[model samples]
Target: MYTLKKSLGQHFLTDESICRRIVASLEAYPSRQLLEVGPGGGALTKYLLELRDIDFKAVEVDDDKVQYLKKTYPAIESRLIHQSFLDMAPPFEGPFTVVGNFPYNISTEIVFRIIEWRAQVQSTVGMFQKEVAQRLAATHGNKVYGVTSVLTQTYFDVEYLFDVPQGAFNPPPKVMSGVLRMTPRAAPLDVASERKLFVLVKTAFNQRRKTLRNAVKSLFSEEELQDDLFNRRAEQLSVAEFATLTFRMR
Candidate 1:
C-alpha cells in the first residue's frame, strides 16, 4: 500500500469521482498541454490521460514519486519534471490547462507563480485547503478576505467549486479541502502597477490587525494618505479598492 509522506504534504485523493469532477471543471479549456503539480500516485493523472486530446506535463518534487510516475507512465516520461514547481517557469506552451491536488504547504506560492504566468495559461483547476480556497474566492468584506483574495481576484475569476471531505484522501488532512477553478479575467477590473499592487497587498495583510492607512504608511507619502479608501483594515477593502489605493500610492 502507498503511504502518505507528511514531510512532502502527500495526501493522495482516494476518491476517483472527485478527481474526475476536478478534471471536468476544466473541460471548457483545451487540455492538450496540462501541467499538474504533485501528482501523488497518479490518481488524477490517470484520469487526465484518458482524455484523448490531452498531453500531460507534471512537476513532482518527491524523488520516489517522480521515479514511480516515469516508470509507471513511460508515455509521459518526457513530460514529467522531477523538480519543485516553484523552480520551473510557466507557459508550458501549446493550449494548456493546469490541474493538481496541490500540496497545502506551498499552495500560496504555487498560485502566485501561476498568476505570474496568467497571460499564457488558459485556466487552472486545483485543490487547496478549504480556507485558502474560500479566501481566494471571497468578495469584499468577508472575514477570510486578505491579500491573496485581492491579488488572485485581480488576475483570475475564482470559483470555489466543491469541498473534498477529509476521508477522500489517503491520510486525511485535518480540515476539509476544496477545488478552485481560476480563469483569467478578460481585463482586470481596475488595473494598477502589478508590482505596486503586490507590495501594497502584502504590506496590508502582513499585519491584518493594522488599518490599511497604517499598514501602507511606509509605502505612501502623507499626501497619498489623504484618500478615504485607504483608511480601513485590509479585510474591509475590495480588490478594486485595493488596486485603486495601490495606483494612488505609486
Candidate 2:
C-alpha cells in the first residue's frame, strides 16, 4: 500500500462514478495515442487501459505510487513513465489526447505545458480545482477570465464538463474539483506569433485592474496605445481580441 504524499498533492479519486465520467469525456475525442498525466492511483488508468486499439502511457512522479500501480496492474508496468509530467517529452510522436486528475499544486502549470504542446495534443480531459477550471472556460467580462482563459482558448475550445464533489476522493480535497474537456480549434487564432500573444496577454493581465493602455504600455508605442480598445481592462478583451492586439505590439 502506498501512503499518500501531501507534498505531491495526492488526493486520489476514490469515486468510481467520477472516474468513469472522466474516461467518458476522454473517449469523446478520438485518438489512438493517449497520455494520462499523474495517474495517481490507477482509478482512471485501469479504465483507460480497457479501451481497445489505443496506445496508452501514464506519467507518475511518485515511485511508491508507480510501484503500487505496477503491482496492482501489471499491464501498466511497461506503459508508465516514472517522471514528472512537466519535464517529460511528448509520449507520442503524432497527435494524442491527454487525461488525468491533475495534482492541484501544479495543475495550472500542466495546462501551460499542454498549451506548449498544442500542436500535437488533439484534445485533453482532466480534473482541476473548480476555480481553475472556471478560469480556463471563462469568457471576457467575467472576473475569472484572465491569462489562462485567453491563452488556452486561443488554441483550444475549453468545455466545463462536470463537477466532482470534494468527498469523491479518498482524502478529500478542501476544494471542489471540476472536469474540463479541451479540443483543438479547427483553425489556429491569427496572431503575430504565439510568443507575442503570450507576452501581450501576460503583460495585460499582470495589471488586470489597470486599463490595457496602462497595463501593457511597455509592449506597445504611445501612438498605438491610444486606440479606444486600450481604454478597457484586460478582462474586457476576448481571446480573439487579444490575438488581434498582438499585431500592434512593439
Query: Model 2 TM-score?
Result: 0.97
lDDT minimum window of 10 residues, candidate 1: 89-98
Write the residue-wise lDDT of candidate 1 on 65-88 in tens digits: 877877787766877888898988
- In order of appearance, the predictions have TM-scores of 0.91, 0.97
lDDT of each: 0.84, 0.92
Best-fitting candidate, measured by lDDT? 2
Per-residue alpha-carbon lDDT of candidate 2 for residues 1-250, written as tens digits (9 for 90 to 100): 8889999988999999999888887767789999999988899999999999999999999999999999999999899999999999998999999999999999999999999899899999989999999999999999999889998999999999999999999799999999999988877789999899889998999999999889999999989988999999999998989999889889
Give the poorly placed runs of model 2, Cα more than 4 Å off.
none
Clashing pairs in 2: none
What RMSD value applies to candidate 2?
Answer: 1.1
